[model samples]
Target: MGPVNKNTFDIGPALHRAILGAGGHDVAISDSMLASNGAASTREAKAFIADARDAGQTPLKASEVEQIHAMPDKAAAKLVALQIDLDPARSEMVAIAQIEGVWCRAMIDNVPLDARLPIYDFKTCENASPEACQKTILNYGYDVQAEHYRQVWQAATGEDRVFRFVFQEKTAPHEVCVIELGAGTLLIAGKKIARAREMWDKCMQANQWPGYPLGVKRVDPANWAIERWPKR
Candidate 1:
């Protein structure tokens, strides 16, 4: 109803476009946004065990919602196999805090076992193998996300917390994997966050919004593309 600040740097969209390229995956922004919204809504619905009840909260079409709800049973079972609880006390909790003069927010997917232990964030993807999920994390700038959440949690509660990702496949025979970021990974992520924050601060101060880098750039063909070329 009121004026919305359109200039805010949302990590999800910013990182997705930056790292994955606007059209790299043949995914348009509108389509990607819709998928993201649906996924978030599904997570919330599953968290509350209200998938059967129509909450009328998601922007996704009714059919889409039903589809996700139906497919999650296998994935849900995988979570149970791991003994991970989704409805932990602080699940789907939102927290906002100021870090280095930037307002940061995080919605924790779940806090299993005890709150003091590691926090878990659920991710539905094409593959749930540790190797595949690790690639997804890097390709999607999830490292930045890990650092951002860690900083926000510490800022809000003065206690450091470990961040973990629970990845599940979106297709049938839904597999799941739990990934814990080690100390070395977090250290690398911290540097990335600092660099991104610096760029954000500069843009905010200068009131200049720039898109992709300027000037002509050389593009290399993918290895598969090169392989497809004539065998000369």
Candidate 2:
């Protein structure tokens, strides 16, 4: 119900994005404001959950929630399998990968196994196309985000991995497009790490609040790009 332990590991494309944004730029909000905002969002989410229960939706029991919390390695298992196309027999044992020198505290599926691949992050829009997704990496400077995750994934899994972003429309599923790393994907992880380090250093000096600098990319301009990846 309450925000899970802050220390609980959650590393995906978005989380990496948040960390980069938080560490890099001087955010408008102060640390205290950010904490308060987190608390409010938690409360609102709980209220929404309670409302769902009142509406006769199957309410989540404490044990069910605990069970979900208890099994955190499923994501690792699923991502390694999905991204690498690694079947259990052809490759080394699938194990959960660690980032920030810590493994994720969430599961990919019901079965608990180590996930050895980095996941692509996609925020879908209703009208996204594959081409648009690719462009997002170029236009928005998400190259850094994808590169950082790739490095962490590779370190944990000993395999090359990529994280992608997708923005889609809420009303139209067909409008979704993905954002992926391009030429920069081949660069050493140290590059993004160093960039993040610089951004973080700047933030620390500026007394800035930390979070991802999420810029909403309008679908209007990406129409041409989306057309390039039109559904078959």
**Where does model 2 exceed 4 Å of error?**
1-118, 138-141, 163-167, 173-180, 185-192, 198-232
Candidate 2 local lDDT, 23-52, one digit each (tens)? 111112122322353432454445544554
Q: Per-residue lDDT tens digits of candidate 1, residues 1-232?
A: 7444342212232222222222122111223333355443344434432322233222333443333554446545766787755654555667788878877788766554455787777676788889998899999989889888888887887768889897766565656688998898899999988887788878889999899999999999999889989775
**TM-scores of the models, in the order given:** 0.64, 0.36
Give RMSD to native, each candidate.
Answer: 11.2, 14.6
**Model 1: runs farther than 4 Å from truth?**
1-67, 70-72, 220-232
Residue 123 lDDT, candidate 1, scale 0-100: 74
Model 2 scores worst on lDDT over the 10 consecutive residues at: 21-30
Each prediction's whole-model lDDT (CA): 0.63, 0.42
